[model samples]
Target: MESVAVVATDRAERYGKQLVGHMSRKISGEWTGQSGYLDFNGRGRVELSAGADALKLELTSDDSETERLEEIVGVHLARFGSKDGMSVAWNRKSSEAGTVQGPYSEEDMKAFAEARKARQKA
Candidate 1:
C-alpha cells in the first residue's frame, strides 16, 4: 500500500535536508539535495521531494505498517516545520486494505477501545 502527504512551506529544501540528515542517523536513508529516500529498517520506505513551495512525501509499506509509517514521518515533519505551522495530513488512495492493522501502541489501542465503547453506549 502507498499513501502520500504534502506540506506547503517556503523552506521545503531546508526541512527536506534536515529530515534526511536526522532520520539517516538512526535509519538507512539518503539525500540528494532535491530528493531523498528512507528505509524504515524494512518496515516501510519514504520518498521525499523538495520543491520551491512544497515538500512531498510518498510512503510505501505493507498494509500492516502504513499507519506506523505515517505516524513516524508525520510527527517528524510536523516537528521540523512547526515554525511555519506545517503538519502532515495523509491522503490515502482507496484500496482493499483493512483499516485496522496491528502492532499498535498499547496506549493508542486502549484509547481507541474506550472511544468505541463510549460511542456504542451513547
Candidate 2:
C-alpha cells in the first residue's frame, strides 16, 4: 500500500533535514536538497519532499505493515516538530490496498532513487 501526507509548515526544510539525519543513522536514507527517501531495511520505505511551505511524505509498504510503518514515521516527525504543531494526516489509496508487492525490494528502491534524481535534475 501507498500512503501520502502533506503537512504545512514554514520550517519544512529544517524538519526534513532533521528527519533524514536522525533516521539515516539506523536505516538507509538519502537527502538531495529538496527531496529525499528512506529505505527501511527492505521492509518498506518513505519518500519526503520539502517544499517552501509544506512537507510532502509518501510511504509504500505491505498492507499488513501499513500502520506500523506510518507510526514509525509519524511519531518521529510529530515529536520533532511538536512546538510547530505539525500534524500528519495520511491519505491512503484504497485501490492499492492488498496490492503492494513485497513492500519494496532492492530493485524498487534503486528505481525510485533514479527517478527522484532525474526529477531533481529537471
RMSD of each: 9.3, 13.8
lDDT of the structure predicted as candidate 2: 0.78
- In candidate 2, what are the lDDT values of residues 1-122, reduced to their tens digit? 89987878888888888988999999999888888988998788999999989998899988888877877787677667765656677778775432121234456556757987999999
Clashing pairs in 2: none
Quality of model 1 by C-alpha lDDT: 0.79
**After superposing candidate 1, which stretches have Cα over 4 Å from the reference?**
95-122
Candidate 1, residues 19-69: lDDT per residue as tens digits? 989999999999897999999988999999999899999888988898888
- lDDT score, residue 62, model 2? 83
